[model samples]
Target chain A: MSTNATTEIVPGWETVIGLEVHAELATATKLFSGAPNRFGGEPNTNIDPVSLGLPGSLPVLNEKAVELAIRVGLALHCRVQRSVFSRKNYFYPDMPKDFQISQYDLPINGEGWLELADGRRVGIERAHLEEDTGKSTHVGGGGRIHEADYSLVDYNRAGVPLIEIVGAPDLRSPEDARAYVSELRSILVAIGASDGKMEEGSMRVDCNVSVRALGETELGTRCEIKNINSLRSLGRAIVYEARRQVDLVTSGGRVEQQTRHWDEAEGSTHKLRSKEEAYDYRYFPEPDLVPVEPSDEWIESIRAALPMLPRERRRRLADEAKIETAAAALTVERGMDDLAVEAIGLGADPVRVLVHLENNLADGIGSLSAGPFAALIAMEVDGNLTSTQTKTVLAVLVADGGNPAEVATELGFEAMEAEELEVIVDSLIAEHPQDWLAFTSGDDKERKKKAGFFVGQIMKVTGGQADGRAVNELLARRADA
Target chain B: MTEYTARQRISRSEVAHVADLARLSLTDQELDAFTNQLAAVLDHAADLEALDLTDVEPMIHPLPVHNVLRPDVVGETSDRNEVLSCAPSIENEQFRVPPVLGESP
Candidate 1:
């Protein structure tokens, strides 16, 4: 059955999508121990007895992980109720502890909504907290383990606190699913809960995709694509998997429910396992970790502490700062929106601040290190330097941290007083008599052009110390006379 | 106290699948052993179902913490020599090890 070409239409095709995104909580220590939660350490160096699952080492809940989890739940509009930790019982060499301590039936967060860019809202089923497993590097050639060599395990990431967000089958297309995941990551970053770095395995996503007949009440058989590292890969995997399923169904064949691997290089999904071959995991309550009950006051405090989320802050920037949605999005995209606001509070013009942040700062300093750039914008807005000189001062600040004023002074940006600017303008008009005569004899447009040239010369001679606005006013008054 | 029973048990084959996804190597015997052990452990969780927990609230975290954040300051860690001394392999002020095949030089 074919429907509208612009819209998705298949006689019996409805895309069912759900996401299980695991975001590594930004904490200094592991979820159940004091082991550092840092990435890229000497293999297994970040481990402790508790993280390594040594006998007699009991897991203590990291207070920071819980706070971050609550902040995440609150940001997602999830219900932060009492939740219990259960052992997702399974034996794996990477899972130092054979059982993964996670929350099952009663998760920490339940039932939230994420508003998509298309103005569509998707339901968040549940977001629960758990610890991460160790990293395993498969050894030998051809990239196949069965062929050869022993695997080396790195426990650096093991036991890091992770919050897994599960979404309902509300995503209609791959694009919508991608947008939802992106927004979710942005929200997590904004709330200061997770780094949301997909490349570093800090944030991971698994997509559950299936296609059913249009107007069908029953859900279609779904296959899960695991560990999608990037947003681009996620959308590609969904499209490829959905089309594969549709082809299978239309050919009078059943689409097998399984976990598929997304080969980002090959741009296809390879069957990892089938449902019949899937693991039971045998989840049970972890005996070691006690159940956690957050007080109502604690939950409220976390809720109040949540910084402005990306969507809300984006809307506010658009309305209050009169910035475009895209510009507003850039400010919130990198967790620099707060710094931008702080810079504005320190006297930066909103429009110029947005422009500087989006164009110059984003390009020169990089989004992650925009702190000094924001400070430079504030300095310029405070009349410490001209806009041109602010760029120079910013470059110096990034290359070598120094006081903006000192750097500006060192670079010869000491501003000229109004009287000094008047002197420069008077000299320029006197030095260029031909331009003055042309300005007096020409039409309004020609006169304005000549006046603009004279103002530019004055600014150039003053090393941009002559305030352009004041110089322009002086030049206009002199030219009109 | 209520006695627990095992239900929805996982099989040895399922454990092996999980191990494969996790890039772990487990012998059949080890899989079988873990399956049985995990099943027994799950049996104990059945006790949670029997508890009069309807009135008892579920707890998510132990501590009542909110906004426990550090200032975004990049502080210096211990000296490089002090840190690199712990590395099994080190060269030129950096930790060096076997190169990952697909990683860039």
Candidate 2:
């Protein structure tokens, strides 16, 4: 995909998107009770009185869930505050209790920013603690909710801890929204706050998108698109919805504030309800549960115990290896940045190590120590082995533990002598004089294309034993002469 | 002045709206009675609202307590058959509810 979106998604208009990501906390018990917070069970097997919302069942806050929530807040650089739980009242059968226990006025985390791989920082409004509701399956023709004959509810997920991390309206494009969610998911997984699994409903996203004329300070009536499970769906839904709103305004209609469901199959959104028809969730503080006041000492201890987050790790590798944060981010996320750093420390070329890490080791480095890895790169760097031979030996080293030199010898792979490379390159150039003319005097694109042709012939003659870099240098030098 | 403000504070339609939110189908007579009753309740609290509370911090809890928590551990879950049978409707080891209206938040 192109790095940046096209100039005008809709001409003379821009999109403002704020995403609410709800990640279920990884805790053994429910947020407000000991109901065995397991994902899948035989329907009601995980339910207790609290989860079922039986009359007179009181809620007890889970300490581990709070700690995980605090870990999330600290990892995201939000101000962990003394937060209170409120009862968000609405008519939902999934929540056996008429109201969902959540934080409204005060959230545990506030005002954090997640930095994308491109270094654009998206503002986080707040991450408030809440309880997840039960799962409902509409059991009728087409499984559509409104038209279903009946619905079945499983209380297994009810009362499980969740943190709804709300992002500021800082995104201007669907791609930016995806980047924000991706970076946030990485951070969530790094901190062990949530598994960040969208497929299993562990992390869900709701996007509030508004479009207005460019350079207009005020925002248009935003529509909320709900439950986009995957990153692709999030991006596509935003694009479709934004364009729909643009078409509506351009065709002399006003955009309405509504909760719309993303129809993945149709590639559009369907309106669930409008603002006037929206539920008046009368929010009030829960008298059952008190404010969660984590002391400064406790919060400091949690901050101390947090692992180095993904962004910080990316920055560390980028600085140490002198690579772009974008490339460093991929290496770090793949759990290979440390190996790359160690190889760089052993005097191996940092850029080459990153390239091999990104391309060659996609499966993973697998039991290969940094010592052997560094030695392999070092051989290629010192011209003792060609790029292809180095890759073959590195594969052997990565798959089965072996010395770089022994592996190269076992495979009968060696760098062509510089004079041998010269002979091959001189022959190829003579054979393709027309192409060589283009290589020497053609435009920049043509010169690059012809250089690739000569290099391919040299590699074929040497049976992948010739260094492509050496081939290019010889071709350029011959052309100059 | 008290009667006028009390009528303004609670309208019959507002009472009916609250009843609708609670999923209660109230009669016109019931709405009228509830409106006056709610207004009287608000009238009682009106004396407190008029106080100069600028210097006072809003109390979230009557008792000065906070941070009640329990350890995360797998504990006793209610017997499935027992709870499912008690539900108004049960199907396939799950609680069967009528066609639901709102999405879970």
Candidate 3:
């Protein structure tokens, strides 16, 4: 099996992939209780009777969870419909209620489409709401769940609201699967519904991979791969699973439908269990809760509150602002897209604003507001200070939080007098007589190359405080003299 | 009055699987007895099939209410010690249970 090559290793076998993403909604309280919906607290401290499944306790649906779900649905272009809650009956120790309250037939968001960055559209089957289970820690026997002597259940995470987004089996490769997850994660974070942290298990993915003969429209038996924590692992698992299935079917063996677990340390998937005994979850409507039918006014309000999503923002930056693809992606991922847009809206140069925001500085642009940032760009553009000095001023504004001009003066970025810069440029031109002669007599190509050398000399003597454009003008005048 | 029209019998293995999922340790004799009793319950409920329920949607919950919700405000979290008092076993303030075979898929 080739790890690097997902391009037809077995010759005539195509892989079909789809993903199921489970994202925890960013709500203050638990889905059905007043327990604080938080992460990494003392075990079981963020629990209430409703979350613990105590007898005679009824669940009160969290209105904010529903609103966030609607926002996510609209972001995914899904139909926000009248949905109902169902009790998924099972006897898991992690589930204190002995059943999970989830949506069965009618999910809140239905029939949506997610367009990848490359323009491949993956249909969203449904995004349904459910309550999360408690976290279980396996104790003893190397802490592996299969061999542990005992398990401890922390109900703090129980009853956290989750929206499971199921994608249509339209993905054809491992890269496509990764792209789908990345795109979905950005949208989740953009809408402020989830933190979209795969490492923290705030967002999780279950990948279903299958392989079929080339040009075969009918699908093959798919083995679901779970326990994948990172996007890199998702790509690796899909490649490995597809090859495993293709080799099995092509070599006189049949693919068995089962669930596998991806071991990140081993870089391989192990068979968790065979899906021979089909689980009849015995799903029925939850008796303790009623249906959710959002009024048009409520739905419209949620729709109206949606911020500009990642895709639209990226498109605007690329098409209108002429920002590069990588820079636009970085700005959006860091939540600096709006700041750049605001700076540009204040008549700042789009190119300069994008460069500063995408510079990966020590302090984020969020530390300084739009007005201060625009002023810094304006100063740099007007030749009051060099680009380096402008960055220093921006840093002080971010770290110490003050007016940009005062910080610039305090940091000695107040513009050098014209004669002072002239003296520096004159000395550099005289010292580099050979390069100056070559630049004056050389063709446009050589002149353009040596122009940078003269500018470098002047900036080096002035500790990068002299503006490069001003030094260039001075050097051009000296050549004419 | 309702009359039975259709009642499908359940297999013994099916009964055992259901018991396993429910975490009930049932013996062969208990399984045999409960299989018969459960089939009787199903037969009794099959009387509904005799009436034309095709036009009527299946009632999920017998309630006229919909959209029962509460505001997203922090009320009161139960005391950890008080909540753990009801558990049969506790370790580090968490409920301890026998090691699970594995997580369900």
Candidate number achieving the greatest DockQ relative to the actual structure: 2
Point to the candidate with the largest TM-score. Answer: 2
Task: State the lDDT of candidate 3 residue by residue for B12-97, as single tens digits.
Answer: 78889889877899988898888878777777677777888888987756787788999999889999988788889999989999
lDDT of 3 by residue, A402-437 (tens): 778888888778687899988877777788889988
Measured against the true structure, the TM-scores of the candidates, in listed sequence, are 0.64, 0.89, 0.83
lDDT of 1 by residue, A1-481 (tens): 1222243534457777889899999988888877788988866567777776777988778777888888888888889877778888665656766778889987889888887543467888888999998876656666554443445666677788999999988887777777788899888887889989999989999999998877776889999897588989988888888888988999999988888888888899888777876777767667666666788898999888878777887776676576666567766765557656766666557877777667666644433234455566666666557777877777677677767767777877877776777777788778999998888788989888887888678767865576666666777677667
Candidate 3 at A240: error in angstroms? 3.5
Candidate 2 residue lDDT tens string, A1-481: 1223353578788888999999999999999888887876788888889998999999999999999999988887789998899999987788887889999998888888778887778788898899999999988858877788889999899999999999889888888888888889898998888999999999999999999988788989999999698999999999899899999999999999999999888888999899999888989999999888999999999999999888888988998798788879889879888898888899889889998999899998987888989888888987778776777788888889878988887888765788988877888878888988888889999998988888788778887777777778778788788
lDDT of 3 at A2: 16
Candidate 2 i-RMS (Å)?
1.3
Q: Of the true interface contacts, what fraction does each candidate have?
A: 0.03, 0.86, 0.88
Ranking by DockQ: 2, 3, 1
Give the lowest summed-lDDT range of ten residues in model 2 chain A: A1-10
Relative to the unseen true structure, what is the C-alpha lDDT of residue A198 in candidate 2, on a scale of 0 to 100? 96
> DockQ of candidate 1?
0.06
